[model samples]
Target chain A: MSTTSPSRWKTVRSETGRALTALVIALAVALVVILLTSADPGAAFQTLLTAPLSSNRTMGLWIDDVAKLTLTGLAFSLVFQARQFSMGVQGQVYMGGLFAALIAMSPIGATPLAIPVAMLAAMCAGAVYGFIPGYAKARFGASEIVSSLMLNYIAILVVNYLIRAHLAPAGTGQLMTAKFPDTAIFPAILPGTRFDLGIVIALVSALAVWFLLYRTSWGLKLRLVGHNPKFAEYAGIRSSFIMVSAMTVAGAFGGLLGSVFVQGRAFGNLAQNFDGNLAFEGILIAIVARSRPLAVPIVALAYGYLRQGAQLMGIRTDVPTEMISVVQAIIILLVASSFSLPGKKLFARLRGQKSANAATPEAAK
Target chain B: MIELLLTVFSATFFVTVVRTTTPLLFAALGGLISDLSGALNVALEGMMLIAALTAVIVSVYAPWYVAVLSGVAAGAMLGALMAFFHLRLKADIILVGFAVNILATGGTVFALSRATGGDKGTSINLPSKAVPGVDLSFLEAIPAVGPTLKSLLSGHSILSWLGVFMVFAVWYFLFRTPYGLWLRGVGEYPAAPEAAGIPVAKVRAWSLVASGALAGIGGAQLAMFNYIGFTRDMTAGRGFIALGAVLLGARHPVGAMLAALLFGIFEALAIVMPNLFNWIPGEMIQTIPFVVTVLALILFSYRAQRARQMRTLSKI
Candidate 1:
């Protein structure tokens, strides 16, 4: 047990080092781009790195984002651990939010049971959405990447259609549902801020996922299938069942994010185009955490801080907020890459050729 | 009903189909080449977005063709970058492609905002040039069916004609050439080619480069002709739809074009439908192509699985 603990610590340390290296490199690249574009690079950089801490309200927003990212990160991490790339988190989020709103706006929302019912509805919606791609992949051998992305577009459009047609009031001229009932909403947990019970949900979900992955037999089977499907099958594990269940569970987490977002302090009503690629950002968080359940919130906190900082920076400085995505892309590429590059190989090859030529000259001498 | 039928069957509709299909066909052909070489080229979307932005920005100062070429170069460079990460650095191809996409989505907007002096959404402030349409008015000189022939044959962007030629060229290169055979062999069984002294990695890398270049032209066509400017997220999943086209076309260049044309027709219908059917929600109509893509892919997967089952049974 002691031996295993030391090795695990080593792995954690190494992962953290690698993540830091990627972050530093990504930030350096962002700085260069900022210098090229901004007339006041100093101010932009300072704002990007520091502004999220400037006020309590900003800190509240940052913490709120942390909660959302933690949930999304878990959603991606669950399927990643099973070696499946669902990418349906975005669609699932939409479906979850739509169902949550449907429940939250109904007469049941006025009752004390409103929150749990809405949450369950959202999870079911997200699970159903997630299940479609998993079923398609398991039974028909369809590509999950393509199917999930296609479903994402369909879900967003469907949600938009439903809201515009059925939910929006007749003369409001807005594409949002009526404000959700106060009882159905998550009340603020902190004074002077919108931060609420969602953070607790995010933390509890992360803990539950960690327990499921490390303390449960199913997690072992899922990991076995991920490591070697043929061997897993030989060992009598049903790989297809695990794959579908892994995706479905991951999708439940994604669906939960929907209810959290809708019922959270961020927005009291369901609005069109509210996600703004938040689902995609979860993939980045998952990568940064290396798909480890316990590491997800830690990574989410760091990444969410940067995201919130960038949001504030966009308002205050000449730099655009989209700069964060560039940094995100660089971080992902660097984190996924091995340290050895082709440049080193080419350099070594050229040196070898030079040494060989020198040896021939010496022989001639 | 008569008016709708008249519009659908007219030469103008055919022209619209060709115009819309040109970009999809180019991207689909690109997707086919890379897929044949064992690279999925998911970065096609990002590459196209960057290329479209590049083409528009370049057109502000340079000639139209030069702007298009710049777009192609940008895409090819991105492809080379993807290849470096996937092949040399041992990164996952899908992840690398996604990274490129994220970069393109955010980076293009960043660059566009700088280029347009604070307009992050579009390049409207820039006086970008458009690809001149190929006017085949000379066909109007012919007596019989002159006007109809002119309408059918004229006023397409020059790139649309190139897109037609490229379908045949890609088909020939993928089937009729030794290099094409080598690329196919590499994709099918890399070990066999590697044993025969083929540079499998280099072939894949070059395929990715060529794929990116083709996607770049598609982007140029989109920015310069289809819409005549760059808009945020303007590609609007066309790159993804092109991937579907590649599968629906059964991995063949000719088939890819036909599949692209099929989608192009659906997209054209979406554009034309709002005016005729005002009662229908525009969002629902917009989803038709994506819905069709999902259904088509599901059907294709089912058929392919059955075919495999039949082959195994016959062997037994």
Candidate 2:
């Protein structure tokens, strides 16, 4: 009991130390970017640090960012946990949103039932999109990274073509779909914000993901396959089926992310470059969250805050919001790195000590 | 249909093919080098984007060659950074590459806005320099195919000539040289080379640098000569297409060049296809190259599988 408690303390200490180092590096990079680029670093820093909460409108925008980021983060985390790194989530998001928009604008979608139908269409589109890569990986032994990336461009093109050909109004200028009907519109929960129910949906999703992953046996099977597919196969588990299902589930969520983003706004329609790289950002969020389903909401919030605050800094100061991406990149490098910074060797030593206690069973033998 | 076919076979179309192929060829060579060194430089897109912007901004103040060199240097430095992070710091190569990619996406735009005084979309405002093309008008004085050859070969950006020569150079370096052998050995089976006293990490590090420098040249050619200036993400998906070329070309240098030429043909077709088929949306026409890339990759995999099956059948 005594040894277990000490080792648990060691685990927490090491984790915190690593996260702190990454956080420090990220902040330092952000600081340098400000000082080097901005004419008024002080004001930029203040706005960047506080602007997400500065006003009700900005808060609404921040919430909107969180809602979308959280969904994508969850989508990425699910496949990541299964050790099937699928970059197809964003493609699914693209397909999902395109389909949702298509359905929302259809004749049958004019009724009150349109919104749910649209959402379901998005889920199915995204899931089917995801299933392609998963099935290829499972059956053909293809590289998901490469295939998903290729599919992303395909999805972008397909959606672009569809929008340009059919849904786009016979107009003079821009190629975009007709505005979604009121049936597909979300009612704003907060009085002042433009976006609504998205945050609530995202929060509910986070809770559902937590429950599904931590409290369910299917989650156990998925984790087992992710950790060691050969071992899972040896135990009679169908790893290929699990991989396909996991990817399909991820696609559904990713699709839902796009729908939430589009429907929450008054102009609920698909644009040319509709992806906005939320899928890639979701990958970043998952990495930062250490691929934890439950930790996603909080991390997504923090990311959303940085992004929203950076937007404010762009408007209020000379700095560009792109600076947040620099910070985000540095954080990924530092967090993903196995090399503890010079002083952080102490924590690694602590980790080694904790592992040594686990060796006691062999020592007993 | 005849006119469309004529358009496809015209000398102008071949020139377009050469122009488009040059950047993809350079990037394909870069991807090939890193791939053969056991490090898939997935950051090729990011590296090219940063290098394109760097060259475009530098050209506003410096000579074309100097700007191109600066772009190469920037890419090499990034390669070194990737090596430092992935090798020394023990990070996953793909993730580190992705991080570099994400950095490139935002960093180039930020730097571009700063350089061009807040024009985030395009570098139309920069007083950028272009690489001069070599003249081959003398070839026209010769016999029958001379005029055709002159039309195909003359007026290509000087970098396009370098791109052609690099095919032989990279092939020689990879197949006919000892260092190339070491790089390949490191990629295929590192333990054997390590046992033979070769420094695997150093070879990998140099390969990454070489890869970056090649991609940098591709970026330079695209910005300085392909279009005479940079636009936001002007490299587009050339980097990824280069990866596809690496495989579709059978991971050989000559194959890569040929595959790049193949993709270039499609891009050229896209450019000319719009004029012939006005009914088809231009946006749909633009998708041809990307669609071809996905199809080519799938075909490549299928062919490889069939070949493997035949080999095993014969062995049995």
Candidate 3:
């Protein structure tokens, strides 16, 4: 085990290689599909890969999208680390948006104080939402997956109802809330684009999450609990408490993203089409990042770029934009399966006994 | 009021329940077989969705049965993909299931558009074939109860009868065969069978394929018989509901059938309740099936825990 410590870079390289392998497979599949359907697959692929870098505006939009995806991905990584599969990030985000809307509409405070308060309110709402499943799982042994999933639908419906009944703008035909006040919006950092201070917040939150999960005592205990509840119990850690805390933190992060989106881009207005695939996209990002907090931003950026490219692909080609979704699915399948590649044998020889220890994490559940 | 009461007791309601239950029953059986073999088949929703679309598209050019078979084959192919990732490539089964679901959600819409020249929804414009209904009108000539029996049990899609047959077929496959024992042993503890030289990965792979094929049949029934065409998201969470039914049914073929029937009755009511109660919102009525699923699952978990507690107390 001690001898393996010096080869950390090798581990990183191999993991990076595996992720790239998955990306290559996705690209290969997309190429085949494009060639079959379009008159120019090579041009389409080139457009997808390079369109974001072609213009400053496109680059800014790409950054904004990556910021949102990264925030949600971080949220997922936090909860998943505790071995709780909470699919409630979307629900939490909805609540956060609602809180932001309420605050924006209210005349409670000055602009500077109001924005922070609204963001905090959103975070609190998200934390409470997450706490429900965590408590249910710890106390009653309810499946978090089912509860979290059910809550997502409930949240979406409730938000839709609210937007239609009370939050609708005076003359709007569709179910959407009124535009928020200028003061409620986040200050734009990049001119001529939606890019705002939210990117900074997301990056700061990622760092905070990294610190919490790796540098803090509570984080250690949580990881122990996740690795083995029985072993953690023997070590005097309260596994249930850790589970609840982790979920709460995860939900808070999700809420923060929602608040950021509402305050920055949508101007605290809710729309009926707000069932954005952000939560599911975040799940995919978490998988591609292998649930690593630090890796989330990189994966999110890649996804954001792919999404933009796919949209462009749709415009330039006869292929539907859903082809991007197919690519995403393929990426997930390949990345999740990359561990079983034959090349793993080479690493196995170098690590030897330590490789067996790694197997424990796979069986933790 | 009296007429409504009579209608409630009439054969139409019974037939409606059976019709609604057919797809759900098939999906539940699919879910059950995979779950007992430890795979859980979370992609049932996606498989059903894709297969539904496939059945509708293929039925346009082929016989209804051939269309259904093609749907099943498509589902089996997806199952094989999942097996390749899960058993061969060592991917997480749940994640693989989710990937399939995400793919199905987006892929079907893409395919639907391509097939319908950018229609993006309900294959209503497509000239799709319908599964034939079994006419038991001959039963009316037999006896005093024949007319009632014919009305209550006849005129269902031939697929519904096949669904009933599948329930027994799945039961026999899981309990009465040597392969069944091997599959069960693999699910419960793979090491035991691995020691016995039975290929655990192969069993899991086959189970996944069988699961997908069963789900495909359910999808075919939904498209070809239930509404005579495919619609985007027509499976709507039926696959997930079937998953709950798997657990609520105590993981048995009979239990799964009953559970599916219970959900089917509620679904049929959701379809009928708007006519009966003009005051309630349609959206609220549409929520009945999801609400029922969550409640049923909660009740199932509570009962299971109670049973465990009772056993512990008895032992003490």
Task: Report the lDDT tens digits of candidate 2 across residue range B234-301.
Answer: 87788888888887787799999988999999988988898898988777787788778877777777
Q: Give TM-scores of chain A for all candidates.
A: 0.92, 0.89, 0.90
**Which regions of candidate 2 are displaced past 4 Å?**
A1-13, A172-175, A211-218, A229-238, A346-365, B313-316
- Highest lDDT among the candidates is held by which one? 1
- Per-residue lDDT tens digits for candidate 1, residues A160-218, read 88888888887788899888999999988887686788889999999999888778989
lDDT digits (tens) for residues B144-195 of candidate 1: 9899999999999999999989999998998999999999999999999999
lDDT of 2 by residue, A1-365 (tens): 12488875675455556666787778888988889888889999999989888788888898888988999999988888788778887788888888888778888568888778878888898889888878867765555666777788778887888877777887745678767877787778877585587888898888887777667877778878887889999999999998989888888898887788667763477788865676788877787776767678888888888888888898888888777779878877776776555644467587775422231110000
Docking class of 2: acceptable
Question: Taking the tens digit of each residue's C-alpha lDDT, what string does model 3 give over A201-305?
Answer: 888888898889888998888877877779999999989999999999999988888788788763446676474676778878888777778888888888899
Worst 10 residues of 3 chain B by lDDT: B1-10
Candidate 2 residue B181 Cα shift, in angstroms, is 1.7
For all predicted structures, in order, the TM-scores are 0.94, 0.93, 0.92
If the candidates were sorted by their TM-score against the true structure, best first, what order would they fall in?
Answer: 1, 2, 3
Q: Write the per-residue lDDT of candidate 3 for residues B176-209, one digit (tens) a residue.
A: 9999899899989999999999999999999999
Candidates 1 and 3, the one with greater lDDT? 1
lDDT score, candidate 3, position A231: 97
Itemize residue pairs with steric clashes in candidate 3.
none
